[model samples]
Target: MCDKNCSFDLSKRHLLKLSAGAVAFAAVGGLPSVSYAASLTKEERDAMTPDQVIKSLLDGNQRFIKGEGVEHDYLAQQRTSQQGQYPSAVILSCIDSRAPAEIVLDAGIGELFNSRVAGNVSNSDILGSMEFATAVAGAKVIMVMGHTKCGAVQGAIANVEMGNLTSLLDKIKSAVGKTKFDGERTPENYAFVDAVAKTNVQLTLDEIRKNSETIRDLETKGTIKLVGVMYDISNGKVELL
Candidate 1:
């Protein structure tokens, strides 16, 4: 019913139509149809509530623990975030090299605003940063994260003094005293050290609210949530406190 040339032309036309349809689908989806990958937009970030943001972080940590991290095209994410950032949370964490917040939480670039200090303690400057992150940058959650076996906690317990470090360790001393540990209340006891670390995170959370009325008002108004967490370096696990 059809000549060879006519049949070949019909097949070619059909293939072209299919290709066009695929392109149309990809365009509507905002990336190649085969792969959909992009950074969080302001609209997307705004759609999530503080609770949802926290849940997402918890889920991300679970994935990290399972070794099932989301495949991220870091280069693509970096390129997309240049326009603007819409981070969902601001994290205050220690400057320990092993306790990187992003890696532990499985957060991608532009997903969080991280402020790192030695003991994860809060000060006027840190409070100012939190205010800006929540009020100005639209972050919905503020997390004060501490880790187990923290050297800063050890320093506070041992009363180690070295130049400017002496003054910095003073801030953490309050937490060391506040921690109600019965046995071996010293850095030599790992349990006591970790207990102090947890207490420090709680103290930092309290200090943030006490120091920053802007952050306090935001939390009171239900615009943001403030929470604390502890990271265990022995096993990549984050415990919400």
Candidate 2:
């Protein structure tokens, strides 16, 4: 057999035609074969210790801060995760655009189960989802992440009311009492806002512990570990506890 670079005998061989797209990409590294690319063979989800899971998030945050990330295949990962997801961790975060759990953590599909709500509140449903993530979906760790300068935290702080938002903000009211800093408690109060964000995550963590029996059992047996973190949007780093 001739080498891959060997030319075929022109007089004896028939011409093999290539598609326009293929010919166009022939100058480059070769256009990706759609049929082959669509196949989801590399479904290896890495194993991570609970502590490693936490550290990985922090490292990813650092990458995000530096404007670097592992931006990868979207459709391929989605197709692979269509049937099942083996995420390494579960993140309960506030539904703030600036605080997106996946991008800030530099996570790819099937990497972490993200549970987002206003103030990252842990009601029965959120707890249930987290329970499913760890117990059923095989997530090794759970994270309650809250961000700085949060509108929800401010709304709760200011006691703003509109539609059902009253009730949603009410869930964050507990953090006000938890904010026992040496200064005032208002959004203008940067120290207070910062404290509120931290307290909110810690509070949500407690709520998760209090509300979910399944998660509690998992935590007790060390099958899963729970942690709280505050994401600073300005600097893009997670302060984990």
Candidate 3:
């Protein structure tokens, strides 16, 4: 019959005993010790330059391509980031099931601020979100990521019009006109689709700089960066454009 205080002490003692046993087992070479990296703290995120942040993401992608991604303890990260998050980059990528931004970039929880749409197109709402992510939340980079064999790019190229999706695809039509592909300019031609997707990424980045004075000012001051990227679905590689 233990009192409440005694029960608490016993629980603490039990945890300490388990921890000691685990450490001892590792010390004796009976078990391998594993430690997961924690989520980025405010100081760490603030200390990094914009280019450094982008390089880190690219390196992570390399690791992912090598099938050597870091094993994150997500529960620990979740608990550590319960109070706040300080992501260094905001990524605008396609909503394709095959191109998950975090997994492709080998990012863990609280490492990136990600926004996804069908064609990676941006509107006022997305602009506002970017403003919040950068101006308010202290993100240092804005990356627009497009992928090969995109259905949205195909739809936009085909002038697809269905219900509300018509207006969304209409926004991407400008890139179709801007793309200069010598080969067959059709959705069935995957090369043409990829070219249009690249053009769309560049156009979207240009639109971001043109539309958002806050982001443009940040870029002008060298406080942040605007980047364009294309992902290859066949090879799991990202090209920095």
Candidate 4:
């Protein structure tokens, strides 16, 4: 080897320039370079299969559980979805701050059309919203999620009451009555509270299936799938129901 001794040899520099030029040439010709989306739009994500869609959501939840959540592009996403949204999932979850749909599911913009209320009940307005999500907006899946140690569920178990909150708590009473725990019916009984939570999610899912004609038709046609989930606040694993 000739001793160029850490100096930039002209021929070697020229070859380096040639290599870079060839790389630029190939990139310009689009020879399998990455096609990144600066932001996801409704039309851009249109080609995903059903299994792919579910896997995407599950991956996001994995990230969330590990606290490796991605940075937000919410304003950019809001602008992109201003025209329309083809959300992949319709989520019915509790309104607990810790159980926010995006954070819990680790979904990005335009991923889920979320509908949350106490007990995740399927009232008329919620059913209407879900109908729109599945029928009008073309969501692929509907998830009804209940959380552990839910205050509403506890209130229902003990018959707790307030002015307007009474009615809200009353909605959950059905779950309490439905839950057949051999022990006491007090909030102190963790088993009782947990049972009611699961029962409420199941009951809410049943109500959605029975009441919403749009969802029923979609389910019958195999156009959409409905499932229930339970979020454990202590340990972030979402148990699929």
- lDDT (Cα, 0-100) at 163 in candidate 1: 97
lDDT of 4 by residue, 1-241 (tens): 1121322211111121233434334434523332222234444334333444455566567768889665656776677667776677789898988788778776656668898887777789999998988888777678888999988898888888888878888878888888888988799887789899999998888888999888999988967778888888888878776
Candidate 1 lDDT, 1-241, residue by residue in tens:
1222221111111111234444334334433212214566676566556876777677678778999776766787798889998788999999999999988887777889999999999888989888889999899899999999999999999999999989989999999999998899878899999999999999999989888899999999989999999999999999998
Candidates arranged by lDDT, highest first? 3, 1, 2, 4
What's the lDDT for candidate 1?
0.80
- Itemize residue pairs with steric clashes in candidate 2: none
Better of 2 and 3 by lDDT: 3
Candidate 2 lDDT for residue 186: 77
Q: Which ten residues in a row have the lowest lDDT in candidate 2?
A: 7-16
Candidate with better lDDT, 1 vs 3: 3
For all predictions, the C-alpha RMSD in Å is: 12.8, 12.9, 12.1, 13.1
Report the alpha-carbon TM-score of model 2 versus the true structure. Answer: 0.79
RMSD of 3: 12.1
Backbone clashes in model 3, listed as residue pairs:
none
How many clashing residue pairs appear in each of the predictions shown?
Answer: 0, 0, 0, 0
Q: List the residue pairs that clash in candidate 4.
A: none
The whole-model lDDT of each prediction reads 0.80, 0.71, 0.82, 0.71
